[model samples]
Target: MKKLTSRIDKEKLLLAVAAPLLALVAALVVTALVILATGKNPFPAFNDMLSYGSASDSQVYILNKATTYYLAGIAVAIGFRMNLFNIGVDGQYRLAAFLAAVVGGALSLPGIVQIPVIILVAMLVGAVWSAIAGILKVTRGVSEVISTIMLNAIATAIIAYLLQPERLGQLDEAGTLVSTKPLPESSWFFTLDMGPAGQLWGFIVVAVVVGVAYWFTLGRTRFGFDLRAVGQSESAAAASGANVKKMIVTSMIISGAVAGLVGMPTLLNDSHQFDNSFPLGLGFTGIAIALLGRNHPVGVALAALLWGYLERTTGHFEVIGYDKEILGVIQGVIVLCVVIAYELVRRYGLKRQQQRVGAELAAQAAKTDTEVTA
Candidate 1:
């Protein structure tokens, strides 16, 4: 029995990791089969993706991508923990990015001051925007899901209207795309001198700091406990002296502020300008990362890294005459697999616990019978 329990424990741990591993493997296998069916050599394509993904430049690109995803993932996960479906992250991030770009473009301060100012503005804008949803939910009993979704549409329209050269016009004179003027070089994110890799040191530092802060806030803070209590049962929490309304609003604000940071990697490090085509889909992608990571900060970080790696590698697919859309298929498959695996593992764990309790009860009964007979 001891050996059985030990084996089960090890198996559970293995399953926890293996689920994601298996998902990746399955995605690759399916991709390869698709390539073969198309009469392309999967070996060469896979090799190219692998090589490019590991290259110095690709590593830096992955790091930048990971940073964005990490911030967005944490934002989504925060809402998840509070039982709030904040689909407005896209809108929140867009508004924040626009505000940050505008602030950076208008500012003439030193790098230290200018950059921080821009980031702060972004966070404030995102927080305020998200708070609207929370307020509606608290005061009017509106479902966050409905409110956030509507807010996303409104945000998209606002960005579209603002991107025009006439209204909030900041783009270059030459007709190119919907964009803002480039921020001053002084306000750009600090890059690590990694030769051709082009690492963004600021992103790495910020990601680590945010991760640690988030962990502590959720695990140790009184506010965090109140938020979790509200999430578990709003009535019970309210009865226990917790302010459910305040918790809801607070959770949304924090989630949006975290999401607002997502644009930093692009605005401060990569582009320094707001563009409509500058990967606005990251907010939605963060949802997948949050789900895949099970809303855990460390897990979310790992999930973001995996996503970044896959995204960077997917560019190589274009070289092999394959559409980069293959990455989408892979992502979908992996997310599905991870969700299924998590459910299975959870059920298995519950079953094990039940069995352990049953065994203990049976042993107690047997001992009692023996004692009575003697």
Candidate 2:
């Protein structure tokens, strides 16, 4: 029994890893085909990407980019684990960042106090925004997908309205752009100077912490089991004494809280203010990353890094005469491949388990027959 259990565990692990690897290989093949169709040698482009991506400066940049993506992926994964598709992560993080920036800018407190305050404010805003969808879903029989989409538009409008000179925004000395008041130098997040490689964001450490917490919460706690149970079957979960409605709301809130952190690496470490230049559409990217990673914490981190590497390398592809659309092609193909690959692996594993069970049962029946004959 112990040996059988160990074998099953190892097989499960292999299948889990195999899905992503298969997807990656499929994506690469498709990308190369596309590039060949474009009348260019695909090998050189791949070689260029690898060389550029491995450079020291590029490594620093990728790490910084991955930090933000890691947070975004985690935020989206939380919702995914509960079978929730939170399309509003983009808006939630944006609004949270803007508010946090406003608060950070207005405060003159020391770094220890001000930084935590800003982070907490971001989390609160994101949670409240996401909760709107959850509340509507439970109380009014609304779909979270639709509600969150609408909330995203509303959040965008609210930010546009508030970020004006007379409101929460201020004109920069350059007179070319309007933005939130800049956070004081005291409020700046710490960084590691990598000398020629550039400065690395300290927020990477925070992202690591968040990943650990996510793993712990979802794998080792009762709430995690309830959440997963609800995701699999709401009726069954309720029959098992779980409060379905409360779990929905709580999960959304927690997901949004993590989404809130998605913007901190940029706001606290780089931009130091909210402005029109603040990145948009990252919430959508989070969806792709979460899916690619199978919603696992460590998997999400690896997916985030892969995303960062692609973005960094593909942007340079434009400079080298490759069409910018290649990036889209690669990303789209990868997502499609991941979905298909995971489904195939899942079915294969299920069939293998069934076969094993059948064999074991047949062996037991044969043993019983022999004993009876004796």
Estimate, for each residue in 120-236, the C-alpha lDDT of model 1 and write its tens digit.
999998999999999999999999999988998998888888878887655566766767777999999888888767765577788889999989998999988888888889999
- The backbone clash count of each candidate, in order, is 0, 0
lDDT on C-alpha atoms for all candidate structures: 0.86, 0.94
- Provide the lDDT at 237 for model 1: 93
Question: For model 1, where is the 10-residue window of minimal lDDT?
Answer: 169-178
Give me the displacement of residue 297 in model 2, in angstroms: 0.2
Q: Which residue pairs collide, candidate 2?
A: none
How much is the lDDT of residue 245 in candidate 1?
Answer: 89
Report the Cα lDDT for candidate 2: 0.94
Cα lDDT, model 1, residue 67: 88
Instruction: Report the C-alpha lDDT of model 2 over 103-161, residue by residue, as the tens digit.
Output: 99999999999999999999999999999999999899899999999999999999999
In model 2, state the lDDT of residue 87.
Answer: 90
Give the number of the best model, judged by lDDT.
2
